[model samples]
Target: MEVVSSVRTPLITGGKTVGDVTQDICVRVEAKPPKSWFLAMAISLTFLFVGLYAVFTTAWEGIGVWGLNKTVGWAWDITNFVWWVGIGHAGTLISAILLLFRQKWRMSINRAAEAMTIFAVICALFFPFIHMGRLWLGFYWVMPLPNTFGSLWVNFNSPLLWDVFAISTYFTVSLVFWYIGLIPDFATIRDRAKNKVSAVIYGALSFGWVGSAKDWSRYESVSLILAGLATPLVLSVHTIVSFDFATSIIPGWHTTIFPPYFVSGAVFSGFAMVLTLLLITRKVYKLEDYISVQHIEFMNIIIIVTGSIVGIAYLTELFIAWYSGVPAEQYAFLNRATGPYWWAYATMMTCNVVTPQLFWFKKIRTSLWATFFLSIIVNIGMWFERFVIIVTSLHRDFLPSSWAMFYPTFYDVGDYLFTFGIFFTFFFLFAKFFPVINMAEVKSIIKSTSTSDKALK
Candidate 1:
């Protein structure tokens, strides 16, 4: 009699064994950080310092340092916060929601996406905190503790408070999800440890796991439970972020359609971001076999579908504004199309509405360079989408006397640069230190699909 283990075989192509898969991931994960890592770190650190300097200068001088005026109160800081938060959504959606849906393809890229989510949320946090000139008292906005200065309670009805709750919850949950998934891989690294320092560090992180059957069982169960917890959380985070605008009395922000609209846009941009990162990681790490053309094509389809939903939302907003017959609403819609910020509006339409249509072709979707370019376009469009929504609509309120144009000051621009630095800086570090691909998930996928490999081949 012979004993067979499913874990030993290749699940997809049958061209490689499970050992091959593990070896491939180990090689990449254990490799020394490249020269590019140092270069990127130096540049990002420089920019981060510049960003901090600008923030402190603004804080010391007052909010007057920013281009934001009484008429246009929320400027680049708030816009960047919303944009980065939306970008962070794609990570949890891919890891949690798609995992629950049993999408095997997500296994190849979920690790990097989850890392991106955590980092993007970190970047998002800077805006709300620093945007308040008196950063020391920033906690007053959310703290339920009694304040003697004014004896005023924090506004429970305010969407800003909701943002504080929603973003904090989203960030904490994402961090836990990411760290949990890394435990097994960290143990794998621990066992393969070649030095005392590496052994102790990895051992401590792995939590004394010996990968027993019982441990694997509990691990799998915990992952599923966490995924279940994260699914609604991913949706709720963006929906609440939308309420920050939708609950407002401003014309464009007052629409009932904002929650779904923002969620779809968040997913669309999030997928775009995931695509951008995975494309590079697969190439850099030589995991083309794990992150295959098929995976890229599947995600492209998602990008197209969600992109179309966002495109429809754009048109529908216009239709509803007209049909509502509210003068303020109609004017806001008209302003988006033909107002002072029409250039920004046109840029959004081009990037969000038109550029993504190229993915309808399989050639474009699978072409790494093409997808990369489109991803940047999608990001640019998404940023402009927020800009157009926040700035253009507020530039001219209900009254002509209140109308004003908004432009970003140097501090405003520095804040945006800082956000980019934060996102890329964390990503660069992630690529260096961790297995950007989730080895455990990929191994499981390989194990489960081994039988299908024979038939396909």
Candidate 2:
């Protein structure tokens, strides 16, 4: 017989019952959205329009319109690409890995986190296409197609080519996994939906879920299968992304530690992004009972672990540069800390390294305001970390005569703002339509007497 301890705090607070969980989550879906949602949508649309104009300018006049010197061919584009990709990492980790571990706390946040992974990956994909100058003409070049198709073959040796394969596969798997988890919840909404149109739409999305024993058995099996498939991707996707730099011969780019290092940094930033969005969402949607302080603390603990790993990785990079006794490598890192872009490096260390350490104090980690503020600070630091890694390393060349600093044009900021517009806009819409909390899973947790009995005893 298995024994369970009741010593731990409740994962779902407020003494919520199965019925309470369903009603609370389903009401958000059934009711008309509040005025605040409309106001928020209006602001996001404003940013979206600005971003669209910037993308249009880049596509029309070419990437040459932005500042790119001979020495620094990559600037904000790759930096933001890596940053957004990193932001997407936490969702799969939270959804797949935690699910595999049989962690019950994930029930509340997995829906939004999985949705975040989808949207963030979409935003990350924009850079490489835009970087090609004429995305419409060159976009197909990256497709993992047969050379025999005779549209010609992609350069198999290119790191960009590998990124095309890895990120796309990651996106496809995440989308399916997210949608799969939503089916039963969709069915719930379908049953509760009063309008004919609402019933029809949700019924279709649910794919005829009937809550039968056989249907549930199949659902559990499929979720496990998909979770197993996604678990490796959490580690592999970021590892492959790290290869984009690690496989290079550049002084700062070549490193063996980058795979694990990148993975940890990705989780660090990803969790911060999740917290940033979730904190506001719970308050706005009045989901405090489902997403409680305990949940926030649990997430904060993970942030601490990942943040420390990232901090160690940062120090490891510095140590390797010193211990390797390679002048170019030494100068490369030294330039990052003391060169023209030293401020960026400083910001990265302070935000990613220093701010997260504050979570060591329970008072701060559990405080909603502190968690939200630091989460934003962590993401800002991560963006600067990418910028410092990309621009600082490239700005100083072998010869001082060839060295040049990269400067962003209007498009750089605008393209980034474009992604912000896309992410928040889609997120708000998702919150408005779908059950933000996983209604099916939350009900199961409360309804499962077998699990609750063990804890009760």
Candidate 3:
């Protein structure tokens, strides 16, 4: 079927055995934290504290501190919220969808990808909460709770309410799926723990996974069941997120193509994020054998597919608007390409549309440096995609008096940095404690991920 590639490549390069896989992955847990890791942690913490100050400033004053005016009410924060949610899509796709298809290459990458899903969702959740401005006081107002103050029962049809449902459900399922995958690897760490403190911690996390035939049977059953449950979520959660705009009366956002378009773009950005993280991790941990060049190439190919889909969606939106003879819709897209924010639109097109096409040549896709750079570019473009849809649509209206250009304050920039801080800090912590690669899964596929041609045949 040529699932990933027609010309086969080794999934794992080193002639590693079962024990080698365990040792390679578990050592990251048991060993002393590297100086480089600590240095990286310090930098992330610096960003965290700066972002904390920004949060305090916002809470102390109000969302008024942001550059949000009447016209461009939903600017950077909403853009960031949607961006992070989309960034999270690849993890579940890799962990669930690929697993369902029984793809062999997903084993090494799925564990880290799943963790990325959980963390990215947490980051996404922050925007709406903080954007509420008094969430700490009346966040419960979002729920279906009975109120003593008035007859209000929360708008059942509000798009934000759909966001509440979507983010919560998506977060829960992805967390469970991630933790479930970690159990077997956690058990492996427990068995190897020389220190009592470490052993106890890993033991509790393992949930008494004994790796027996019965245990394996049950494990397989539960994993498959979870995968089945999660597969629909990978589609539904993002569709609901797209509903936040698709349901809107705004010119740029009012379109039928949002659901599928959003899903593909989510996968696109998610895979790019996974590659960005994985490439750095591979270099730092000397894990080139497991997360091989072939792995990078496979992912780059997916970037190509999804990136192409996004480009087509861009054109489709323009065509639909023009063909429908809707002046507002037509201007919305035209203003995007040739208006005050034309640079943003150009950047989106270049990064999301043109950049990924370079991967049609195998060399660019296979090159580690090239993959890392393009992955980052794709994410930037996707962020701008959301920004364009939100800000450009709202910045100028049918009423010229309502027209205003949105400029982000330090609060907006800082809040975005805050998510980055939280994401990397947690990721480094996760890398230190958890097996970034699924040792048990990789061991099960040891014979399959071989480097030698003889093994392939």
Candidate 4:
């Protein structure tokens, strides 16, 4: 038995061979889902139908059905948009950023993460479209198309328009990158397909992948190129989203730190989401050996660092508000921490900042149960972080006379649930119908796991 050395520790465990990797991942797609999967699907579909009903009612009755008023026009719609967009970032980072850094740990997690990224962006896109009262016209109107009305075009200066381009580009790139990575795995599934339907679908998706040395050579080259393209692209997506607020003259929204702060928060929430989804996924699918404790520990470390950065950003906002001596900014910060919605502020502080700090302990970071709960807490804190930024800023501006409180209606809650439905529906389908793990990439690392085991011996 020849021993192979690796740069870092092994990613796979259980002494899996290449054949074992293919059989393990492919059988997941070929078999019927467990009873738990159906229960989850039923729950997801209930939310989905509820969301659809809300969307239909909103369309029939108009945007007035929800909680939008003159002062707090954005409310939950934009907050959910930013939150979903932030959640999408971790997927791209897991796939592209880690790939660029040549981190083998990413190989175990990136496929599912990339799928999560695509689904999350899909959820984020719903708000802007649904926010338009006349969604029919608003859809094409937002695009920079040559129209019969001469020289009429979208505002190039608007960050909202920039978001349109940024998100669309990010989605396109992520989709292509994810699909490209899936080709080899898809081919693996195609080869092992027992039925004609599975064979044809997987064959078409694989694009005639033959597993030649030349084919693999090109595959690696393409993956590397795409990773380079996606690295800055993911960062830019969230940064542009932050610009939607930072470019505003609103007292709390106008901050120079918005870009990096938003990016860190996005990555932080994204990792929390990945942890939440993957923890359940690995256990449900019996993939603990592939996704292992070491991988969880490393992701926990990222959450700790990014969570700390977010906490610092919170304090920095307070310091800058007071240091500037701008009365409106000062009052905005004060209102956030002590206003009618102070509970939201407190929740954000506790969840986003304080909770993730537990990862600093080895015991907490490595514990699957602990990581699962903290991941959910981090997302909740992140949601509040967005809510605090959007609603708190808009509800009270420079004018004392224009001040008002924001509240979400049943429809608002429904649309938020809709995103969850969209996310989980797509995720469960992907898990069952496709290779959740990247078989080819994991195969390359099988020997690395063996080498590490030998070293321990």
**Ranked candidates, highest lDDT first:** 4, 3, 2, 1
> Least accurate stretch of 10 residues (summed lDDT) in model 3?
1-10
Clash count (model 3, backbone only): 0
Candidate 4, after superposition: displacement of residue 353 in Å?
0.7
In candidate 2, stretches whose alpha carbon ends up further than 4 angstroms from where it belongs are 1-4, 146-151, 447-457
- Candidate 3, which segments miss by more than 4 Å at Cα? 1-8, 149-151, 451-457
lDDT per residue (tens digit) for residues 4-85 in model 2: 4457666766667777888998998888899999999999988988998999999899998778879999989898899999
Q: Taking the tens digit of each residue's C-alpha lDDT, what string does model 4 give over 1-457? A: 6555546556787776777888888888988999999998989988998998888888778899888788888889999999999999999999999998988899899999999999999999988988887766666878887867444878999999999999999999999999989998888888888899989999999999989999889888999999999999998998999999999999899999999999999999999999999999999999987999999999999999999999999999999999999998999999999998899999999999888999999999999999999999999999999999999988886677988998789999998898899889999999889899988898887766643345444
User: Which window of ten consecutive residues has the lowest lDDT sum in model 4?
Assistant: 448-457
Point out the higher-scoring one by TM-score: 2 or 4: 4
lDDT of 1 by residue, 39-152 (tens): 878998888878877777877888788898767888788888988998899899889998899887788788999999999899888888887778788877567667775457
Better of 2 and 4 by lDDT: 4
RMSD (Cα, Å) of candidate 1?
3.3
TM-score of each: 0.93, 0.96, 0.96, 0.97
Error of 3 at 45 (Å): 0.6
Candidate 1 residue spans exceeding 4 A from truth: 1-14, 148-151, 450-457
On lDDT, the candidate that comes out on top is: 4
